[model samples]
Target: GKVIEGTLSVHAKGFGFVLVKKGTDIFIPLEHMLNAMDGDYVSVEIVKKVPKKNPEGRIVKILTLQNKEIIGVFKSSKEGGSVIPSDERYNNPIIIPKDSLSSPKIGRKPKNGEFVVIMRTGWNENDHTVTGKIIDILGKPESKEMDLLLVARNNDLTIPFPTQVNKALTGLPEFDLQKELKSREDFRSVPCFTIDPESAKDFDDAISLVQLDNGRFELGVHIADVSHYVREGSAIDKEAYERGTSVYFVNNVIPMLPERLSNDLCSLKPNTDRLAFSVIMEIDSRGIVQKYRIRETVIRSAVRFTYEEVEAIIKGKKHSHAKTIHLMQMLSLILRRSREEMGSIDFDISEAAISLDEQGVPYSIRPRERIESNRLVEEFMLVANRIVASHIAKKSTKRNPKPFVYRVHEKPDKESIQSFLDLLERLGLKYQLDKEVKSDDYRKILDIIENLDYKYFIEKVALRSMTKAYYSTKNEGHFGLAFDAYTHFTSPIRRYPDLVVHRLLKYYASKEKDKKGAMKGEAATLSKKLDSICTHCSEREIRATQAEREFIKIKSMEFLSSKVGETYGGIISGMASFGMFVELSHYVIEGLVHVSELKDDHYDFDKEEFTLTGRKTGKVYRMGDSVTIKIKSVSKEEKRADFLLV
Candidate 1:
């Protein structure tokens, strides 16, 4: 193959791999790296090929450098200043020129040990060190604001809305109630209400329940009509598309759209009439949708209830909207059962909710409690998304279907499934998993291990076995939700795909017979363009997810930094050749237990069993094993913690 081009993914161990589009990654030895850093686009030639082993390659050319901006702590020396990168993968410190302080446009001078953003200018081949100039000085190290800035910069998240985007917002006209209502169905009389987090600023969706006289239920799912204000090809829309989705950090939110829209115009505030794209469904007691209609509508939310409030109502502790809450609870249960019957797997992993003090410092990390209120909103949103997707799929013919974005999840690879089964066997779990397993097979294993101590560990493994879900122009269906066709039809304010779906729905709804046929050519053109859009959106979404996780990790480390030497109960979440990862029971943070810390005996790692076995003592530290560990050290720069077994 003529020198294939791919993105280089670097490891902390000096070597890296070039991930090509259509095949296995090509491993590049350290000597053949050709100065290419992580996330760089490079052209590589396969130099060594073995039948079973990974193909080794040499980077022939670096097409583009991905990490042009570096965020790190500044260290001033008598000779000159340098930056120690937060990401340890870049081993060499970036040499900062003394002239950086004289440049007023580069912002305030960075003090020693303070976080700074460096614009990589060049590299010194002789010393193997990168050179850069300090562009912005972030706050002091270990500060919450500095942590947020580092995470944002490292993930390439755009923090500020561009001036042009903000200007575009000014020209956008306010929702003319009388004019807009003329074109949209009026659902103002519907007893609709929004359920969201207590601290949520943007309420993108609302739910309403009405009991029909004929013993059926009408469910109204109203999503804010963001497309009305953010027109396609506008500055705001382009920025939103580039962002792909809103990123929610522990203490801050980087919204995809400006506050002028996301928080005000697009937010479905209670007692305020708002424009929305509504999905109204009529279903029987069994959660089977008898009929449904999707249309542009105007709705007035009667009330706004937090998840806690709704949960309280469900539990009969509150009387406000008790009837509606009961009806929603009933429908949600039916929907859950129906979905479970269809082999939908529910991996209810606990997510950490880091509690922050007034100064934005993390004080505690606890598992976020999930209640019926959360499930109610989720089940309704799932049904709405599925309904919208089915509508598009039904209207679309293979020859001339409207171009649409789908959330696709392909079946897991056979190798991954076998590996998971092997893990189950090693764990001594008596569960049967076939080579060619279906969704139900995994569900059965999960059910059997529901009450086991290793349930979460097994759940993580099962999740790892499946393919990651992504956006696509073609409908491959969603494996996790067990849906034949699915699109993001809700949360347009936060997600770009949902906004695109809304636009497509409007375009198709307005097309006449002749125009519809003429639009076939446009659809074909759109289908081709959607491939790039899907890929970009998927990549951006991953970046957002990583930033979110990094923020949480940073906060967790900060929270544990003050408690070094204290012992805590934990479970081994992962294993490696060097050490095993232990996640504390009370806190969601995970730390490394290096094999050297097993002072009683020398330990050897068993790859297949995922255990650290002591040669002399015959003691094993395996995945899901409970142990007590004393915090040895915490590195905010490395964003990790080290633990010593007690």
Candidate 2:
């Protein structure tokens, strides 16, 4: 009935869809796209309406261009040069003028088959091409440098801090130890320590534990005070908001802030005094929070312990903080039990750790182990987040809650849950679904299958049935954590939402004298802005996750490239009419076994049972069935591997 505004998501085939904030996507055919490229904000008028299928639309106007630069492979010919975009959404190649290549600004001409970053100058609709100039050369394809650059450019991740941002950082006040101690709660004498990976350089969180005289424990979760350094609306703050979150690739990181801030000023380095937004909770021996306080504080970390070291300490190995470590272990277990009793679902999925050589090529791939030390830190962070969120939620009524960002995990849809139950029934597993199935029901099913051979497959299916968590201005509660209120309040150095939480908390705290008056005007402004911020942060988080997964996949394929013809045992992780995916044992890599590779007999796919059965021979290949397979081939560019049944 009227022109609607939304972000245009262009497909590789020239067609696209306009994703509205509160409605279903409007499908725009190729001809009706009105020259709108991928990631363009556009207004569209509905041309056709359908009940079940997507509504058709025609682009009315281009509001803005979201993607201004592209990373692609440069192909030069005698006729001219063009760049084939690495991002599939931008199907058309960008035409580059020969003279522009040799320009003084460009420095040198890009060679054929080289990867390059191109800044869009203009678009030629009639010619169906985009015009751009070579901004940077990103080495050869499949190389580590090129792969990382491609991921960064495709995700719109800014690699370098702007001059203005750097200048703003330089103008920031140096850490005045005396002034900070006077202004903030002095926790410098506390026995605080950081636990992180051995390779980590930026430590954003620290923990401290003390036995209280009242027979309770004082558990402190201190987060790096990033918001203190990054002033709101400043160049640095604006840049950080746009980035939304730091992206961690397998071998590199694209930080939201400058290295000066993230790695030095805001890092909780051992033996150094640092500012922190701390959550101090007085929790009983039973893991119940009796009281808590959120405060700006100064802390000096007594030591830095890696997860490996903590694990050893927990295993009774002698260490300097052995007593504190034992107490932490005890508290974490109590808290974990408390959560489990409340129906928190723990999806204990292992991730792949790809070891790279000096050249950035993967030398090995192994499943990363999750130990008790990891859980000890995680449980504390979760509790700290919950404590802060509950404080905010309680301070403001449900009808008029404060403007805050929450990490929300919604309940699974009924249809997905039913499908999961059906699958379980077919697999001969016992699971009685109630009218309203809580997370505890799922946990029960998981516990039953914990020792089964098909446990991983079942867990994957259950996970797929669940919805993804995202940042939202509305507190819908975190179903996964079994918390009625929760928000990310830690790791400001890496996560932007955590930084935003710190800023909002500080803003609210500053208006304690006129809380009601401040909530009426300033809170309204914040509420309006939070919607967009939450949406942007959620989208960026998804993009970062995708990029990380793609990086891992690329490296996994590379690791298998040299192992062609090698045999390994694998479980059938997935099945389709065309092929089946097999996940190798002891490795996190999955390879496809095409249906055509089953040469012995004609196969029939049973979708209901998720199996491929041989018609004459009566042999079947089912999900979770272990089989021997030989690596057939590897495609590094496609991030794929082929396997043949042995």
Candidate 3:
């Protein structure tokens, strides 16, 4: 028997899978598990290996528990109390004795049916019972606030700012704004403005444009100087690093930094002199950068325009900066075309914009419209990220090198790419890839399928084929944006990596001016520090993204609860061994249509084509297939919906 160790992911049903480093996951039946829960790291011994089937393994050891603390709804009984896990994937309840509640951390006994968190304690394997101590009592699950709180707790997101961080903020010393202004470059004279979402408060970036005498355009991208206020290794910085990135849950946001810094001091509020790291570039009409300057500067934005307002301006509306915005639009188009020509893969994906009322009830959920204004801001940020990455890369030659964090997107694997191409060819669209798949090849395939009814399906498949972009000390380049170098340098208010990038730039700037000595060996130390930070921050980023998506899914489930049994037009968005996922046409929501619901005929799953063929009726259900489905059930607790094909 061979033993392998990996994290265990338990299904809602009792069985689980051990996700190893490579290949198919090892299947662990319920009886074989040693009461190991979901997210637990465990060692398994391979018992059987059959061809064309996943290797079967029995859990030999429970190395460590993934979730030390669990979130659940408390139930008080005469004997004691038991907390039912909120995720439901855990499928186990923790019992808490009445004595454990005498001096609970929350200072009171949790009411029956109240949401709470508990620390794991000893357990009995014979009775399949586990014990825990109540630590915190979250609100009742029926409460309006519980919608978001439940999602946050389930995702392991700690929302409240630590008291130590707040105390450190109060003890922060003040600096003279005027004195600091004299020491940095001044960009206050530029006619700059911030364009963000209508509800945005933390304006971290601003845009300014000027026409140069050499028949070139001067584009200025200014970002908030968050690192200037939150000193490194301070309590505030430590807390921000722990949070890593902000979690935007509909209207509620869990900011990485406290509001005092993210919303006030570090925010680039309009009509105020704020410290900034600005990148000014001189470019020709075709969007080729002739020259660029990166500096620390003081800027005063004249106004803050929302994307909607700018969209109106683009459509011939009148504003003081209407002409400037129009100019920005022209420049964005050129830059977009230039980048695409250089093989940038622009997956024209639309993001869902869920609108909720004051009570956290969703009134509408639809894809956000792509407009010229959105493209304008995107082009500027992409250019700035690329230019900053290029600047840092050049400073590090072979002999005299510097350590920096780069956002790298590696080339897609050939197997995944072949699957994507096969799907396109099956749909009657023919496209070819070079010896090595070029970014533009995917872009060209997208263009061919642009007007197809199943374009979204094809686009998603292609996107999945590509590797996820991440931070690294080594430069693998950005395949999506077609950039030789790229980094996140635009939003320091919400992202920790951006703040670190700002610090690195400032350090280089100071070193260049002072020509200083005795900062030797700092590069080596900083390199190690940055490499570890990149891995931690990347993990935190994925957590934040999952929490955000889960919140939306939870809310969507709530919205569909009353519509049970109602029929809606849907598209088959995904396929799995158990069921097919259906995307409801009316709303930005998807639900599962389990195979058991297909009672009309015995169905055979076509693994290669990702389709379910009805043996008697000759009906095939597949990705992008349109069908009418009735909502069967909605489990708000589990954040899942069940659909039946009508």
Native-to-model Cα distance after best TM-score fit, residue 431 in candidate 2, in Å:
1.3
Q: Model 3: number of clashes?
A: 0
In candidate 1, where is summed lDDT lowest over 10 consecutive residues? 512-521
TM-score of each: 0.91, 0.88, 0.93
Judging by TM-score against the true structure, name the best candidate: 3
Q: Relative to the unseen true structure, what is the C-alpha lDDT of residue 217 in candidate 2, on a scale of 0 to 100?
A: 93
Please identify which of the two predictions, 2 or 3, would achieve the higher TM-score against the true structure: 3
lDDT at 108, model 3: 85
From the highest TM-score down, the ranking of the candidates is 3, 1, 2
**Pairs of residues at least 3 apart in sequence or in different chains that clash in candidate 1:** none
Candidate 2, residue 611: Cα displacement in angstroms equals 2.5
lDDT digits (tens) for residues 1-646 of candidate 1: 4599999998988899999999889999988887677888889999978689879999887777685777788899875699877887766677788876425775567788988887776655454455678878886875657777788888888799999998888898778999987889999998899999989999999999999999999999999999999999999989999999999987589999999898999889999999999999998888899999998999999898899999888888767678888999999999889989888889888789998987788888888878889999999999999999999888888676778999998889889988988888877876665656677787888998999989988898899899999999999888888889998999899999999899988988887423646466788888888888889989999999999998888888889999999999999999999999999988878999988777898899989889888899999888988989999999866888999988
Off by over 4 Å in 3: 1-13, 17-27, 31-35, 39-67, 173-175, 516-521
Per-residue accuracy of model 2 over 222-258 as CA lDDT, tens digit each = 9999988988888998898888888887768888888
Checking candidate 3 for backbone clashes, the offending pairs are none
